[model samples]
Target: MKRFFLQILLCLAALMVLGGCQSKSEIVKLPRPVGTLAVAGFTNPMFNWELLAGYLPHEGQPVNKRVIRELDQKLVQTLGKHGVTAYARPAITRQCQEIEVFENMGSKREAAFSYWISVGECMAADYLLVPQVLFWQPHRGMKKPNYNVQPASVVIDLYLIDVNNKRIVRRIHFDETQQPLSENMLEAGKFFERGGKWVSAMELAEEALDNGLMELGL
Candidate 1:
């Protein structure tokens, strides 16, 4: 009996060592950076489109600024693997002043541009990106019990503005929404926070960014 117990313990220890080595070998590898990049804060209301519908800015639900920050950081991580670099930050005072001189921007423009220009100056980034979470409902015709869109789709738009030319250089779009799961997997979807539905959207955006870079031949 003692000999049998010792053999079992040795086998279990060997299995544990093998498992650790296998896990380390399976780690995902990411690519390389072309240059430093940025994802600007949404000046537009997709982040708070509800404010434009009828609710006052003060009454509107506060958006988590962290969402934009996290996305920006994620972009950096993704781009790094593909040999691209991106960083989102605010502009400095002097740079903001210089940026103001370039635009005949109305009052709101000055406020918004000031923030971006300062960051752009500090980072000296080659490219700037602006993403919009356009509103959940645009028409304001339907009064639903909740803001949730059935099918839950919302347009995620991107506009690349030229700092020097003060014009839009490029754009991309993403449509994401809640989807129904298969009857067999229904229990899994209900239990998991995201299951796997959002994985595709994340991949889609990464591909879009990669496509954009390819278009630029970067």
Candidate 2:
């Protein structure tokens, strides 16, 4: 009876996964700048990236650096296509920098005149693109039901703030991360596989920026 109930729960979960996805996404816009502006180092066309992955900890997870770099590259390209003129910033490039610094170093409300000071006054970026990733969780595990090994499912939330404006310019939330059990799960003695969604958190950030920029009439 216990095994029977477990199977029922799993089936229900699978159905929920299939039904919860979105086929299309809406484009959002933000208030455009009053003047032509420079891009920040973070938004600059460079290869540095930051990935925030979250696990229950009770479930355990391996730190994936490769994934973070990939996410950064994707975001850089997306923002470039938009009119914001974005790229990687030096403030974001310090090796082994503290997460808290990235989170709080320069804010929109307080960083206007001083922002350039923080970045050495090169004065290229008139606007600052700030993004915070709140969550990144994976669904599924090393063990599969049908058997082929696969990546785990994941969900992420990313938001952006205009540092000079000192207010949130845009935010994006995505929850449809999913995948199916691999065929290898049906076989015995196979190694457990970790499954995950391929969505880049930075992509969410870029979407917010693009929509925000469009709204700005840029």
Candidate 3:
């Protein structure tokens, strides 16, 4: 009888573990936005980007440009794939550049929201998708004889705003952080040494968008 009880307890514990795993893997669905969606691509906001460059290698210019182009393409494709009826509007894109050049939000969150709302209104879009590159930096990894390791880090922020309501419907953020490894010497070094291949900002942006879309259940 005692042995039988032990076996039953073990089975119960296994079931509990499986149940916990399933709960953790449950998919989270994002509320689908209503009406037309316009995507606005980014241009390097001089202040933020310039400051970020101080920490990364190669001045970070190449990555910045690539990120802008890739993000625009990826966002439209991703949103369309998920049945969001999204398009990148040149008018709004141009306006975003103008705002970055002339206006400085300087940590005022509402000011940024108001700008997006106005853009959506001007474009006649019901929702505006705003994506920003928070950071892109390539660290150095052994490169003297033959490049053995290369790694990079990137951060992206995505926002979906309702033009009619002047409200943000979805806000998503992503980070490309290096993970630690124990077995492989190269990967382990890449994680700690802050060194790796110079990854383009565009590539990082594309990854961030892809991740965000997946998280959105798209």
Candidate 4:
């Protein structure tokens, strides 16, 4: 019996080691110098009507405009910490409008690509950073509620486009929904990081942004 128990412990240890070596964020391609990037701001999944026309069944709740603005500011601040100079939102809007690209955004892939390049040129930026919010579900407060409460959930995608080449150089996609420790042993670290309590949607997104950028070497 003792030998059998020892073998079980060894198996668990092996599993833990394997999980620790796994990458948390999905990254495509390699990172490049972001010299003066123009942040195109975060896009709402709901507004991408053209792309979601046939996929409405898979869509999640739309995030509030205020929440998006907060996340955008956090992204800019995070970029600054990584030594990347980013253009503010107002500048992006002004430049896009000046180039007549604001009105045609998300209409077509080709048009969007041209618009990104044009906006980058107008802002004198080398790259354009675009973020899209896919899902957002805020967690209830610490105070116990009489009703059932759902944990925070968020999904975000980041794209780093080469303005001159008009191509995506790097991309990071983060999707996570908090679950009880019993349900997912692989996420034990995250559970401890959150103090074993529910976290807010903004908090989850902030963590995702930080991790995703780090993975991209930004």
**Per-residue alpha-carbon lDDT of model 3 for 67-176, expressed as tens digits?**
56666667777667667654556445666545543236564444555566667776778777676665666545643323454545677667777788887776777666
Candidate 4 at residue 14, lDDT? 45
Off by over 4 Å in 4: 1-34, 47-61, 86-99, 102-107, 141-147
Better of 1 and 3 by TM-score: 3
Per residue, candidate 1 scores C-alpha lDDT tens digits across 149-200 of: 2333334455554554444455555554444332223223221333433233
The alpha-carbon lDDT assigned to residue 147 of candidate 3 equals 43
Q: Estimate each model's TM-score.
A: 0.41, 0.41, 0.59, 0.72
Question: Which lDDT tens digits does candidate 4 get at residues 12-103?
Answer: 75457555743546444256565766777776656444231223224556779898888878888787776766455533554563654433
Best model number under TM-score: 4
lDDT of 2 at 197: 24
lDDT, residue 76, model 3 = 73
Give residue 96's lDDT in candidate 1 (0 to 100): 35
Worst 10 residues of 3 by lDDT: 49-58
Better of 1 and 2 by lDDT: 1
Cα-based lDDT for every prediction: 0.42, 0.38, 0.56, 0.67
Best by lDDT: 4
Local lDDT at 139 for model 2: 32
CA displacement after TM-score superposition, residue 127 of candidate 2 (Å): 2.8
Query: Tens digits of per-residue lDDT for model 2 on 1-218?
Result: 99899767755555556534322234444556554343333221111123222222223343355555544554456556664453444235322122223333344323322433233223333444433223344333443333343343333334343445544444444443233433222311112112322223343344444444444434
- Per-candidate Cα RMSD to the true structure, in Å, reads 14.4, 10.2, 10.5, 5.7
Ranking by lDDT: 4, 3, 1, 2
